[model samples]
Target: MDALHPHGMPKSAAETEARRLIADWAQQPDQQPVRHFPTAYRDTTPLPAYGTTPPVPQPDHRIVPAWAAGIAVASIGVGAGVTGIGCGAWLVLQGLASVTLTSVLLVTAPFAGLAMVTTAVAGAVGRIRAAVTTHVYEGPVTHHTEITNTSHQQGWFTRTRNDIS
Candidate 1:
């Protein structure tokens, strides 16, 4: 049925007329509402083949819990720091065989310095990469559009047209 014509979403008066017709249809002994929906295949087009059973519906849970993931990442960083501190302490206290404090610290000094330098280099490189770098060229350009976008309405498109056509 045409849900809308000149009118909007249907009025109660129109619905009463439809229900009257439906009641007349239901009163016919042989007719059933089953014929309203197709149940078998046909030549011109395949019928919808209505099933007795209905499909189960599922709930949507698509978004990630940002608070939970943030907590997880923070805990991982904390664990890594704790591990580094514990490892450094163990090396200093339980030195190999009979190594003196000076020799032990001396031996670990290079490794420690290298580790710290590597960590600092990694963090510096990461921050430098994240700092927003862009390149601009000074030259003539045919198109110039600077539009800001938001979610309230459909967007606009523009292009240059030649004077001839």
Candidate 2:
């Protein structure tokens, strides 16, 4: 008797009961097998002809006419031109009211002459200084060198070699 069979049923009797249950299950009728056909059938009805119905009319979507748009653009361009001319006239009047040509020339002529003289003197000094000083090298010079490395790897092993010139 096993612990699972608490009613003290013998092992052989339990085995015989299992075998009977299995035989009873196997004796049941089998489900019918599904069958498949080779050829497929389609509907034989005729389809309606295309382009037989009238086309739907589309609505107009333009908010403004072409002539009206052209007029608006022309008006904007003329207004901008008038505004530019007015601003130019105002700036000229303001400049004339603030300073005169003769006064500007009298105030700036001396400074302009002084600046020209100083520039000439500075240029002459720079040329003399550059001519007096010079650089000379007396050591060996070497060109740039490039190094290349080659590597070979196989399984768990790796080897590398470098060449420089």
Candidate 3:
């Protein structure tokens, strides 16, 4: 139909312009059917009721022995330290506080290096080799602990007693 009469009474210039745009937009490939909403629905939905509860996890008593804590902490520290150095270098490159970045790098690099060295030394010394014997019987103590480097290489051995007499 005719877009606009030279002297149309009610239709404004904006309505005419918008009609032309919609006419043009209809020809595009990826255009969707557009609809305008006057107002949004405002309300909260009733929450759903639930039944069964999740089971709690039982803590395993047979965990890494206390002696292994140091090695584990050291290993994790060294790993985190290395990651920090890399992040510090990146921050320094990204034009962050250069002084702070440099200080972090200086601190973390040495700790990372020292932690790696100590981890290696402690691993070589086999500090993780520990023995724990629980005495369940009151009369006689039957707990044997022996560390033998039978194999040429390093290994771990654990022995535990759990009995009531």
Question: Which has the greatest TM-score?
Answer: 2
Per-residue CA lDDT of candidate 3, range 41-152, in tens?
Answer: 6446554478755454689888778779989999999999999999999987886544587777987998999999999988866754533444565586576665444323
Report the poorest 10 consecutive residues by lDDT, candidate 2: 1-10
True-structure RMSD for candidate 3: 27.1
Quote model 2's TM-score: 0.30
CA lDDT for candidate 1: 0.76
* Better model by lDDT: candidate 1 vs candidate 2: 2
lDDT scores of the candidates, listed in order: 0.76, 0.85, 0.72
> What digit string (tens of lDDT, one per residue) describes model 1 on residues 1-165?
545534674566578878999898878968645547657743565446785544446899887799989999999999999999999988866766567789879889999999999999999999998887768889886764555444433358555433321
What TM-score, to 2 decimals, does candidate 1 have? 0.24
Candidate 3 Cα lDDT to native: 0.72
- The runs of at least 3 residues in candidate 1 whose Cα sits more than 4 Å from the true structure, single-residue gaps closed, are 1-60, 96-165
Off by over 4 Å in 3: 1-60, 96-165
Q: lDDT of candidate 2 vs native?
A: 0.85
Mark the 10 consecutive residues where model 1 has the least summed lDDT: 156-165
